[model samples]
Target: MLNSKLLHKKLFLDSGLKTQVKEVNTSNLEWTKNFGDIAPFMQLDLRLIWRNKRTKSSVWMLALGLLYGLFFYPNPTYNNMPFFFIFIGIFSTGIFLINFGQFVPAWDSGYYKLLMSQNIKYEQYLKSKFTLMALSVVILFVLGIPYVYFGWKILLAHFAAAIYNIGINTHVILWGGSFNRKKIDLSQKAAFNYQGTGAVQWLIGIPLLVLPMIIFALFNWLLSFEIACLVLTVMGVVGIVFHQKLMRFITGKYLESKYKMIDAFNQDN
Candidate 1:
């Protein structure tokens, strides 16, 4: 029996099983080292977004956002209103935030299990997504410079809306992502595609866009347009100041729902 056990051990070593195990452990260690870094994961997410056809559609949306002033500029009805410019800024800069954000981890549903099984940090993953959306806001704002032709106020409204988006709506959408369970296929074209969408996504727009608009409109009616803008700006600044705390809460939500998300993603539908 002792000789038989020795022979089995010899066979295991001779079959290279021990070596293979060591190699796999070494590879896992190296992978953890690389992907564990925020920069690398962020770069990887960006590369995936750029390569995916659905995400690339945001380019057209960005272009349309840049020219949004064209529609309002010619329309005397909306051109003069501060609210119009603010809405434009929110919708324009928020293209990616709305388009890509609603899906959250659902976007990676295909490989989410593999990702979760790895030694990856949830905060790092969520951070990369937040960074991507934040970058989109900046790019959209820059592309919207031509709206200055409408008026400097339009530009100011855009700036204000961009800040509100970065500070407030960005987190809101990410928080909303905690509820996403439907899987999205990146290969699908963006036009009319609503694979991962649900009631949460639809309702999210209310708080992100409508609530602020209502506040601004009420304040504008009660006080002045400038004050309305100031109110929105102050709200955005407050959101920015408390961003870390918000992220912690949002991260906790994600953690709490992580298993549910995994189970949901594993479903056929």
Candidate 2:
């Protein structure tokens, strides 16, 4: 019976609702009934990411980061690379934040709802998020970093930033989405403080870009270079360790609470 059901699902997916039914009557193997059915939906989530222009903003943002690095990188001829790494490494945070922010709402409205409602585990969803995030960061750095930091710092800084980014801000937005309890209709100006969604995106971007620098710069001032880097390294570790706590907080608390609120608004349409 399981095979019978699953085969029906795959037939429906590969062909169409009407055609699959026509074939299912004759076929005993059911491919569609299993939880494995969600695999295609998961792949679709990533493929559909590009259709979203806001998410792709990371590409242009990286271009700008590279341009900024071109100007800001320490003069190699003068042997000032360490200062350059400190500055540019901090600057890269902005790029990562901007990239992460682009996906917050899309996750809220699109994939989060789908995954949470499905039988799929949040663990799988996290894997997808990290995978996509990794690809996005790699693409961004490949485009931005070679021009800025040389051999070792580039690699070290990339991993360091990825750690904090995946740990903190990515988790925050997910946390905020649930904790915020607001459906956030981009069409409605009032939902986002009368400024519009563009304003909200900008607001999110500013902090993503600035927060780490503030952390690093303040620490850098009080301590030596090695200590400051060590602190950020700790944040990177925190990102990996506590990600599940952050996701659960978002899903169970904030997101579940807003179900009725969003339902009421969406029902009218």
Candidate 3:
């Protein structure tokens, strides 16, 4: 009876061992890519974008929209429709872009260290940033339609122009975002002070939201919406591609010289 019990215990132990081994082999950690090629950037960006109130750059836009709806644009007619639609596009896109910036660490000497710690491929990183930007643009494009009281004819033109504006802002943000040196946090007292960007940074971002308005005014002035959209589309495609090339070049330079900066910051900290 004792021998039989020993044999049974041995069998149970062996079975337990096998199950443990199988679990280890099938664990989520064993899976390689957490989020695919663009996962790192997207993950990083998404985290950073919503970490603070200022990160809700969309708030300012919402305020502007509410103000407009309440004051300047209570009801919609053909005369005010153009301005209303353009405002909607700008504010909407601005919200996404604002939040997108929050995800990015400032491209300062400090951020270079974090970036270099990994073996991330440049193209993959760039693609990730581009994809996020596209998502934001799509959100604005879709949402702006409701605010604008126009048919698909006008909608299509605004869509193209708004997308073009997103492209332009993406390129611009990439340039500014490459040097993040600030720590991102969503909580603290004296809340505004804890946020990284200052008034100047906020001012710079204004243009991104304002581009749609500019385009609308220009188109309105010319009295040719289709031609204006074509021009904006051409500009958007060219600008976005050009920014990619520029990003590649700039990052290469920053990578080459960024080591010393990283070392200094690390040593100081």
Candidate 4:
């Protein structure tokens, strides 16, 4: 009477083998099911983020990022300089990726040890983070569709930026986080808080934000605005295609830096 697959899942849950169950014949199961096992990490991540007064307050930054275009959209000064749109595109869509990602494991500094003790695969842990950031980029891009009112070019820039954020910048931020995991005091006020910031965080912007702008500007100058958008989009698409490889690489880096991160996180505690 019960669907066989659902029955198996029910048994797995009831037997407490949810995370350890394997496919009948294959050496590996589907990635979706494996990721499902670690899905609770995503929920925990969301709770921790909301629990942090400072991180929770970053919603204002997202609000400001969305409205940032008002400054350029209405100003005739920016009309001739369409290149600036790329800056807004990157910032508006990738604000969350940039703000939350650079901290990486540092955000879990409060419980870095306990988290490490858990049975979670490092790849799954990082995947949960990647999913959150990629989702944010999609949401921000959709919300920014209203920017099309300015011009289709504005929309194009935002699309390219969103793709870039989802594909490239998310991995870039995660990889950058591998180095210099700083301790954060989540209880502190969000205003001008420099609690967890370090040189790596500042330098990461060069790739996450500046490099795309430079690439776009060069293509725009050498060819045309549409070509520039296409180039950025292609770069993002390439990154998306190789996301798994990038995640594996970043996961290894996290493993290598795990002890270092724990030691660093313990300094303040």
Candidate 5:
């Protein structure tokens, strides 16, 4: 009887071990599958950022944007000026989104047609850009946290601006890129390189940078500084809430301009 009991226990232990190994194998497989799905897109973005001198310049610009507060925060003359703070907040937080996003698939101008020929969906392509821009806002905002040493108000302003950038400005720039899309020569020097600059880049700045300030200014003028910040943050939250819808709309814009952009980019080659 004791021998029989020991045999039964051994069988149960073996079965449990097999189940555990199978579960671990399944988990690892899922992880590998997910990484496989995203690896190409991740590699594409990294290559665009590091291989292109002009696109890489945006990293330096991001560093500059982060230190921008050191110039204004230390000056007493700029103190108590909430509107100026709002401007700095938006510029510092969204600088990358503005610089990088305005170009969009234009950065891929060299191989854009080939890229389009791939099995990748247009919505996926645009969403990747959106994700990159949104990630920049979050990262910039986190890095900007040290500015709280200057004043809590400055931090609040930056928080609102970061939210606004992530939610509204990201979509705005992506949509803008769908219009007047231009080709960028990755071979161009990063210094003073405006290879892809067009009217769209200039015009889009109004909504991305200026419009937020105007909205904040009105609220600041009408009520108080805190109220202005609250209003701006609310606007951003609303934008984030409808992110999927906004992405769908922007993807459609890119689809509509697909042929036109192809023609324009071809002209550059």
Candidate 6:
């Protein structure tokens, strides 16, 4: 009788162990599948951006932003002015964000419904957009390194702006994306493409760009330029530190608006 009891206990433990192993393997497989989905989506986005004229203009815009340093570098007064960095910060980091982000799911309006029918998660879609924009920020910063000739402070400001952009503005733009309902024609020339313009796109700039500039301006005016830069950098650092929480919140917002976005994207306009 004791042997029978021991045999039963061993079988039960073996069964539990097998179940645990199966669960872990299932989870790992799902994770890998999700990872695979993201890579293809990201690659598709890159290819589309390269092939589409309007989206491709983002590269030129970034180039223009890098040249902004040329305008201020020669003038000692302008070079030293703190407000100058604020302007550069906005343009440099915001180039791709403003151009591409304002369109959001609308950019895929032509095939948005088809995409929705797929097995993709809203989190994955939003993450792809965020990841692409974050990457552009890095590339733009690298291109803007020539501005370091003006002063290390210029480089410092650019770094601060890049941090704030990736950490804060990226999520803000995605959150704003929840409100995008207009359709954009990627084939159109970027020069005057207003296909997807909306109030939310316009209003987003205030928080993403203006608020930081305001903070910097006020501090630079009242305290010192150095203090203002530090303040902006600190704000950016805080945002970077809390990025995961912000993404989670943004993902919730996307989920809440998922149906609405799909409906909006289907419209003829």
Q: Candidate 5 — which residues are off by over 4 angstroms?
A: 1-39
Candidate 1, poorest ten consecutive residues by summed lDDT: 26-35
Q: What is the lDDT of candidate 6?
A: 0.79
Candidate 2: TM-score?
0.59
Candidate 3 lDDT (Cα, 0 to 1): 0.56
Residue pairs clashing in model 5 are: none
**Which candidate has the top score in TM-score?**
4
lDDT of 1 by residue, 1-269 (tens): 99999988777554688788887764342442454456666666665677787767765666776676777766778855777778888888888777777778787888888888996888878877887788889998898887787677888888888888888988999999999888778898888987777888888889888988888788888998778888888888898899889989999999999999989888877
lDDT of 3 by residue, 76-178 (tens): 4644456455555444555555555533543222365677678667556655666666666676566556545535535655566566756676666655554
- What candidate 3 gets wrong by more than 4 Å, as runs, is 1-36, 47-74, 81-84, 107-112, 148-154, 179-181, 189-194, 240-243, 253-269
Q: Tens digits of per-residue lDDT for model 5 on 32-135? A: 22544454565577568877788898778899888999999999988878888888999899888887888887888888878888868887777777777888
Candidate 2 per-residue lDDT, tens place, 189-243, comes to 2221422133345455444556765676677679855566667768867876877
lDDT of 5 at 10: 78
Ranking by lDDT: 4, 5, 1, 6, 3, 2
**What TM-score, over all chains together, does every model reach?**
0.83, 0.59, 0.61, 0.85, 0.85, 0.81
Kindly list the per-residue Cα lDDT of model 4 for residues 29-103, writing each as its tens digit: 233344585577776777677767977865657787778898789877877776888999999998888888888
Question: How many clashes does each candidate structure show, in the order listed?
Answer: 0, 13, 11, 0, 0, 0
CA RMSD for every model?
A: 12.3, 10.9, 8.3, 9.9, 9.7, 13.5
Q: What digit string (tens of lDDT, one per residue) describes model 6 on residues 1-269? A: 99999987777777889999997765342432355667666766776777888788876777777676777677887855777787687678668876778778777887887888896787778878887888788888888887787778778878878877887788888889888888878899988767788898889989888887888889989998778878877877887788878888988887788788788877867
Alpha-carbon lDDT of model 1? 0.80
Query: Which of candidates 1 and 6 reaches a greater TM-score?
Result: 1
Candidates' lDDT values, in order? 0.80, 0.51, 0.56, 0.85, 0.85, 0.79
